[model samples]
Target: MELCFGWFLLVASIPAIFAQDISHGSIVVDGTMTVAQTDDNFVCATIDWWPHDKCNYDQCPWHYTSVMNLNLSHPFLAKAIQAFNRLRIRVGGSLQDQVLYDVGNLKSPCHPFQKMKDGLFGFSKGCLHMERWDELNRFFKETGAMVTFGLNALHGRHKIKRSLWGGDWDSSNAQDFMKYTVSKGYQIDSWEFGNELSGNGIGAHVHADQYGKDLVNLRRIINELYKGSQSKPSLVAPGGFYDEEWFVKLLQTSGFGVIDVMSHHMYNLGAGVDPKLVSKILNPDHLNKAAYTFGNLTHIIRRHGPWTSAWVGESGGAYNSGGAHVSNTFVNSFWYLDQLGMASKYHTKVYCRQTLIGGNYGLLNATTFVPNPDYYSGLLWHRLMGKVVLNVESHASPFLRSYAHCSKGRTGVTLLVINLSNQTNFIMNAQNSINLKLAANEQNISRESFTHSLKKTFSWVGTKASDDALLREEYHLTPKDGYLRSRTMVLNGIPLELTSTGDIPSLNPVRVNVKSPITISPLSIAFIVFPNFEAPACG
Candidate 1:
């Protein structure tokens, strides 16, 4: 019903078959696809523990105290965790480098968050109580999240000369923290050193040799402490903006195998609050610029470590906090989903979204911790996409950006086609429509039907189309009010909202027959699932 235009009513009153002759142009697509040789972990999100006081701002909804102690009892979080079974969570941010573990609860007293000119401050000098650390570990275990803890790399180096190589750098505090973690039997998947201290630093800078030395020391400590275990947690370094020469030097000096995951931070879209944020996301050229960085990182990593994987340590689109309304709304998904598609193609093993619950760009709403539009996009991605990345080429207009991957545990491929055009419609050829059965487990609602029916069922079976045609399941993401600029998001015409009890609403997609070629409207995104391709490698 949401797809019907008012003008189409009079036209629909006529014979259903004639309606097909009265519409927009069609763009034929060639579905022949190829799978990449390598496939890495697809999605990784972050839970920022720094600036724990971000909640003090009126625009920020996350309270450091509550987020640090979040438990599985929160249904919203529970559902998200359940969806991404192997979710990777990075647990630190800017303040991490300045923070110290108060083993005895005797560091500086905790202070209220202060609003700095750049962003929120005050996470720099507080002590992380052993109790809070334990609680966070408990929550991680319950959620089955693979944890990557960021350690303080700038601790003793502050107040020292910036050019000095190693005198002020100390690992005693880190050693103590590792010992405590081992004693507590908490398993960390990776331990990252420092926070935004790379290119010219974010208030602090450490030379490549110095940082490499620190990473080597961390590796030694991990080997010594976890020697008896089967596998030790990985050592991640820099955790800052990517500087071509700086990163290459760090990897070379640190030597092969020193860092398991080469991580970097990105805020290429500028500020989330920018008035032209939506325009920027829709621009394919603007979105494609980041590909250079992605390619560069992958090239350097392969050249140096050869074994190390590349990751986007933190990315929230805009910096100095995100855009007020733009980053949090349905419009943001244009950038978010495009990033997901782009990053995976460039061989980024793990892409961590900045702040799981803070600022304006968080996947969950700050106050209620409800699932945002991006959350559902990520959920659908987790459920439908497999590890194998596929190569797909579209002959349609540049506005239609399409990506394909093998369907998760299914025989066919899943295509994610996004329409950036605000006014044009693109159509693809189809043989016969397959009626989708509304299984309770399928997560789609069958009650909401479209007012106008597309029943022409034009058949054009190409050489690519097998005698045994495949069935498709479509999950479309559009604005709640059908406006490209609107913030609210709906899936298959169903608006996603939090229930009265603060629970996650049923994210049921509307099912339809794909008997004929389907039309993709402007400024919308769809995940079309084609089952039974049975690609040899995906299985």
Candidate 2:
């Protein structure tokens, strides 16, 4: 149990005693068209710069997980990353703005982060040594990961007030770092500028107009540094909370064709220490609230930065280092997976999780290098779902969150169904949305508003016009021991754990016949792959 705090210990106290009804839901998968598309590398995670002393709620969770000190040689570390053929690893965090790159720099002494009274976020400026950077690049290459480095946007700025940072951004250090990266042939996928310094800012603030102008300079530097290279890393910026007015201004100021990725962050569950963390994670209303941000970002990007796309540069359900027992537990996948589905629906190219290994929000245990429940969730999405997102219409309770995509490198579609209710089980059926019909008791209807009001349990049929019985692959995930805060995850009755040699276990799914409904147990998630689905869009 990593970061074993009491945040969700009482989640089961005063639990429901009465048994609930089993709901019959029909999930209509649109096969003819796609509503949105994501990047091939949609599953992304982050590594932060927090030191051992970066404690929250009197607990020091960030241990040896900073970009500078992570155990790159650890067997599990490499294997976990390698599991995703090419996991998108975003190397950045709050302290990235206070960081100084130690490459071709002779002005100041490069040192590690030190806790200081007057420093930003109470942490003094940290330094990233060139040698360490080289080592990181080597590890990334060995693990076959795509890297997105966050540059220090406050390099030349000074604190003008309590929260305001002023003056022009100094691109010299970042430019030197990029030049060194290019010289060494290090392959970086993207370079993100700044952290949570948008809106009113988190710990520090900056004007959007100035940030935009500095981004122009950054793009120029990227062009100069990688001039002859056939491909250059993309520019992602303003990795912070979504501020409509500020976002509009930044894009207008930067003009078109400047930003490649419009990245933002979120912590919809509020603070990590809140008592109702588990409740918020399970509540459908709370989960759907993030749709506003994602939807608005889609609109804003379309209007102002049409050249760019959206990326959730950083998002941990709870903000301050995340919740100890809540964020690192199996139940957190409800929030994580739902957000992943929602983001893809809004055309988000990449959703960078807050920490791959740091704090309570890490996918891997900060010190043990073991995968958490959300890690399995991410790996499943990367392996099963493809870039083309199809339309899935379900009129079941909001408790059932469903998303469909063309199966990755396979025919048919993959349906992700999450049952958030702790008392009700969802008997889900996947029918083609082409011309879906109701059960025996209901009248025939079109597929536009395809919802099934159950006359008992609705039957599941093949998406194609065939009498052949097909089997779907299902991966059901539930918390170990019915504990929502349990760190261990049980996948299809088998616990997901590394081998004695520290390798990821095989995630094999159970096959069920097409006539059988996809059974989603209470508080469980299922990634059902219909191998024989007649999806014309995927074809």
Best TM-score goes to which candidate? 2
Candidates in order have lDDT scores of: 0.69, 0.87
Best by lDDT: 2
Put down candidate 1 lDDT per residue, 74-127, tens digits, no spaces: 667766665677678888887676566766433346442345654214343545
Q: List the lowest-lDDT window of 10 residues for candidate 1.
A: 432-441
How far out, in Å, is residue 501 in model 2? 0.9
lDDT of 2 by residue, 1-539 (tens): 21131123224322532355678878888778989999999999999999989988999999888897988999999999999999999999999998998888647678999999988888999999989999999999999999999999999898898899999998888888888999899999899999999989999999999999999999999888878889988999989999999999999999888899999998999999999999999999998899999999999888888899999999999998999988999989999999999999999999999889999999999989999999999999999999999999999988899999999998878999999987887777777755443343355666532343331123233323444655678898988987888999998778999999999999998776665667677899999988877777887
| Model 2 stretches with alpha carbons more than 4 Å out | 1-18, 437-463
Cα error, residue 47 of model 2, in Å, equals 0.7
Weakest ten-residue segment in model 2 by summed lDDT: 1-10
